[model samples]
Target: MNISVIGCGYVGTTTALMFCELGYQVVAVEKDSKKLAMLQQGKLPFHEPGIDSLLIKHLHRGSLVFTGDIEEGIAHSKIIYITVGTPSLPDGSSDLSFIEEVSRQIGAAQNDYKAVVIKSTVPLGTVDKVREWIGKAQKRPLPVDLVVNPEFLREGSALYDTMHPDRIVIGSDNPEAAETVKQLFHSMSCPIIVTDCNTAQLIKYTANAFLATKISFINEIGRVCDAYGANIEEVASGVGLDHRIGPHFLRAGIGWGGSCFPKDIAALINMGNNNGINLLIVQSAQQVNQDQIGYFIDRLEGELHGLNNKTVSIYGISFKPETDDIRESPALKVIAEVQRRGGTVAAYDPMVFDKHPELKLPGVRVARNMEDAWKGSDCFFLITEWDQFSKIDWGQVMQEMRTPLVLDGRNVLDARKLRSLGFRYYGIGRKTGIIHE
Candidate 1:
């Protein structure tokens, strides 16, 4: 089978490569010329582990190809996947202009039966809007089936998540169309859910909202633990052992941030508001996440006496490890807050700095290396927990810093070990008392 993926962003690129891995020829479409050139060369425009290698393999085998022309992509396959971005508008509603434009293009270029699959995360009832847009754009009457196949891939581990999804959801009013899409994933050993378009869209939003809630819930608990001198890790471990909780999204940290969670939660909240239903739990989750950043900064400020004239060494800039996606990243928020308090910022990331050498953060000193981030700094703040951070020489860090203050935002550092090195250590809900000194 041939598949056309429109848009070459992380989700689009990953989806195209996934189809190629499934033995289907894929033609990926991207309007951005730079991204198109990168894709043509088997180079990813963004940082994602394991995707680059798959892209190279597929291009070599003639299974995957890149194109900037939407008409060409639409004509290349009967199954057209709309994986374009539906970024959040200022009003918290999903801006579906991209989806709408793509739909119109597909419709305008359609000459035969086409199964249009929506792989992008969209608001509920968007499938209906897409159907309308596509119908109106067609030069004449043409058979087109719309399918809502929401993606559930994580950023850092996108390829693994795509190749090994927990479930496959095919949403369409037409059972035949749904079944046809379902057969495309017959080799994958996972439950395939066939449902209406609305339900599938809701499932995507609800899944991200619930995960955001879990993160906020645990972070709120972490605040309580901090006040009572309790161990949050132990608390989470005990709570997760109950099988009902299942130990995922239970890790408490600076809080959840990424492309999906914040936007989805906001859109879900906006959905509830438009329907006269106040989603209080989700609203609180959003609030708690925002406040968690302030709470961490407050601790840092109090420990330093004041941030004015202080230098803060930020260990990680990207939201999380193994990816360079900084959209809604908590680290950026932390950087902004630190600067607001008059602190000078020095930042380092294993991937972000190297991948985006031209990347500039206002008022941030980009460190050449991890050691450069902490040198002459007052506090070593670990925001994103890259694996390399876990193996850092804390003793050496203590010696190099003007003041040996360690704030482990992700709580991946050893509190005891840092304290033994004569550095003051603080982790969210972890023991702050000096263990060795």
Candidate 2:
């Protein structure tokens, strides 16, 4: 079987490679000349673990191909997966221009029936709009099946998640279209869900919204735990052990921020507003996440007497570890807030600074390494929990820093150990004072 994937981005590239691994020939289409060239040379435009090796292997074996021509991609396969981006507009609604343009292109180029699978995260009723767009672009009446196949892959472990998905959703008005798309993943052992386009789209949004709600709910509780001098880790462990609430997304930290959660949550809220329904829980979740940065800043401001002229070293830049994606990263928010308060900032990341040397954060100094980030700084703030961060020698950090103050934004550090090393350490909701041994 041959598969064509449009818009070679993070999702598109990963999706194309995934099909190749499943023993299907894949033609990946990219409009960007530079990215397309890089893909042809077996290099990824973005950083994802374990994908580079697979890409190289597939390219060497002639199982996968990259192209700049959309018509070539459209002609290669009966299955066309639209993995283009649907970025959030200022009004919190999705910008569907990319999807619209891609649909028209597919329509104009197709000579026969095509199973047009939309893998992008879009608003409800977009399937009907896509069908209308394709119909208008055609020279004459043609048969095309619109399928909504929302993706649920995480950024860092996208390849793993793609290969081992919890469930595969196929949304189509036509039963044959749904089954045809479903058969593409016949070898995978996950449950296949067949439903209407609207329901499938809602599943994607609802899943992200619920996960965001969980993170916000725990952070809100972490605030109360801080007020009473209680341990949030223990609370989360106890609550998560309830069997119904398995232990995921319950780790209380600064808040959830990434490409998907923030945009999807906002879009979901906008969808509610358009329907005259107020999603109070989701609204509160957004508010809580926004407020969390300020809460952490307030603690830092009080500890340093003021942020004015204070040198604070940020330990990570990406939203999470193992990926260089910084979209809506909490670390950026922290840097901006600290600078806004008249503080000096130095930052370090394992991958981001190296991958994007051209990335310019105004008035911020990028450090060469982790040790360079902490030198002569008044406070050390760890925003992203990269594995190397947890293995740092605190004794060296203690001697090098002008002031031995540590702020663990992700609550990943050993609070008791830091305090024992003559450093004043603070985590989100960890118990303060005497460590009993």
Candidate 3:
């Protein structure tokens, strides 16, 4: 299959590389000169585990070609996948201006019959809008059946999710186009759900909304545990053992922060509002998630009396571990709030600040190492549960910090052992010795 993938961010880049790996001749299109130049030199614009080698392999194999020409990209392939950004607006609605602009470009560039795939997450009936744009721009109707193919990828494990997806969904009014897409995915043996375009779009939003609800549900429970002096980790473990509620994303954390969950949840809220339907549970979950950051800060301040003129060291920055993505990262929000309260902040992450080179937080210093982050700090904040954090020698951290204060926002650290090591430990919704006001 010859394919053109527009937009080369995390989702588009990973999908382009995967299709090329599957032996498709891929023409990757990007408007960013720097990113296009990097791709031409076999360099990825961002950090994705194992993507560098995959890009290099496909470039050497002559299966992947990166470019910025809309005509060349359109003329070279029959299947065009539109993958762009849909940022959230101030009132939690999706700002799909980027996707709309790309639709205009794609409509103008269409020369023949092609499969236009919607790989970017958009509001419902967006595929119809793409078709409408094609009609408006081309004047003479372009022969393109818009397919709603939403991506359900975890940030850290995107490649794995692409290869081992729970299901492959293709939504279109044209049955032939739907089956053609199914046949194109010949390498993957995942369950295929062929449906109409609206259902496909809704499926993606509903999935993310449910997962976000699960996370907020647990975090809200953590709030209750904090008030009653109960341990959340233990309660979650016993509850999750019932085989009904799975253990994934069930742990109480600062909040759910990434590109997908926040945007999609808000989009669904907007959808309900437009149709005059009230979603109380989803709305409450959003509220609970918003509160998590403030709750974590309160815990830290309670432990140390006051954050004014205090030195705090933060361990991780990325929203989750194993990937360098900072979109809607909780660490950024928490650090910002702490500094707003007159505290000095320092942070060290295994990855980040590369693609986002201008990530400057006022009154914050990026640390060089674990020792440098912990040196003489009054308290330590664990925002993301990176694997290396659990393996650290708490004794060394306890020995180096100005005060042996540890706030485990992710609940990844052992509270008992840290307490025995002469460190005051705090976990979200856990009954630690240090109580928040």
lDDT of 2 by residue, 390-433 (tens): 99999999999998999888999988889888888878888743
Give the local distance difference test score of model 3: 0.86
When superposed on Cα atoms, how far off is each prediction in RMSD? 1.1, 1.3, 2.0
What's the best-to-worst order under lDDT? Answer: 2, 1, 3
Candidate 2 vs 3: which has more TM-score = 2
Q: Against the hidden true structure, what lDDT does model 2 obtain?
A: 0.92
Highest lDDT among the candidates is held by which one?
2
> Which segments of candidate 1 are over 4 A away from where they belong?
433-437
User: Candidate 2: worst 10 consecutive residues by lDDT?
Assistant: 428-437
Clashes of each: 0, 0, 0
Per-candidate TM-scores read 0.98, 0.98, 0.96
